[model samples]
Target: MAMHPLSDTDIGDIHSQLRELRTEHHDLDLVIAHLIDNPPPDELLIRRLKKRKLLLKDRIFLLEQMLVPDIPA
Candidate 1:
C-alpha cells in the first residue's frame, strides 16, 4: 500500500517518540554495563534488557526512516 505523506504534527510526534526511545535505549545501555561490571549478574535479566534495547533500536530506526522523504533516483 502507498504511504501517506506525514504532516507537521505527525513529524513532531515521531520526533518526540524518537527522543524517548533513544533515551530509553541509552539508559538501558548504562544499566546493562553497570549490571555486567558488578559481581555475578543475573543472565536472564540482562538478556531481557538487551532484547528490549534491540527492539527500541529497531523502532528508532524505522521512525527515522519515516522522517526521510522517499525520492526517486
Candidate 2:
C-alpha cells in the first residue's frame, strides 16, 4: 500500500514511537527470561508482560506495513 503523505514532524513521531516500541519489546524479553530462570514466577506479571509484548509487536507490524511501498502489478 502507498503511504499517506506524512509531514516531516509526522515521520519523526512515527520513528520515535517505533524506537520506543522496540525498547519496550527488549525489556519484556529480559523480564520473560528472568521469570523463566526463577521457579514459581508470578503468573499474573508474566501474563501482563506477554500481553504488552504482543501489543508492541502488533504496533510495530502496523508501522512497518505502512512503510512498505505498493507495487504496480
Candidate 3:
C-alpha cells in the first residue's frame, strides 16, 4: 500500500509521538520490574501493566516501520 506524502510537520509530529511512546514504554518496564521484584500484593495490576507494555511495543514497532521505507529485495 502506498502512503500519502507527509509534510515536515507530519514527520515531526510522528517523531514526537514516537518519543512519548518510548518513554511511556520504558516507564512501564520499570514499574513492572518493581512490582515483580517486590512481589506486589496485586498480581492483576502487574498483568495489566504487562499487557499495556506489550501493546506499546507493538505500536512502537508499527510506527518505526512506517518511518522506514521498505526496500525490495
Question: For every model shown, what is its TM-score relative to the native structure?
Answer: 0.94, 0.81, 0.86
- What residue runs in model 3 are displaced by over 4 Å at the alpha carbon? 70-73
Per-residue C-alpha lDDT of model 3 across residues 1-73, encoded as one tens digit per residue: 6777667898788899899999999999998888888854479999999899999999999888778765656
Per-residue lDDT, model 3, residue 53, is 93
lDDT of candidate 3 at residue 10, scale 0 to 100? 80
Better of 1 and 2 by TM-score: 1
Query: What's model 1's TM-score?
Result: 0.94
Superposed on all Cα atoms, the candidates' RMSDs to the truth, in angstroms, are: 1.2, 1.9, 1.8
Who wins the TM-score comparison? 1
Q: Which ranking of candidates, highest lDDT first?
A: 1, 3, 2
Query: Candidate 3, overall lDDT?
Result: 0.86
**Clashing residue pairs, backbone N/CA/C < 3 A, model 3:** none
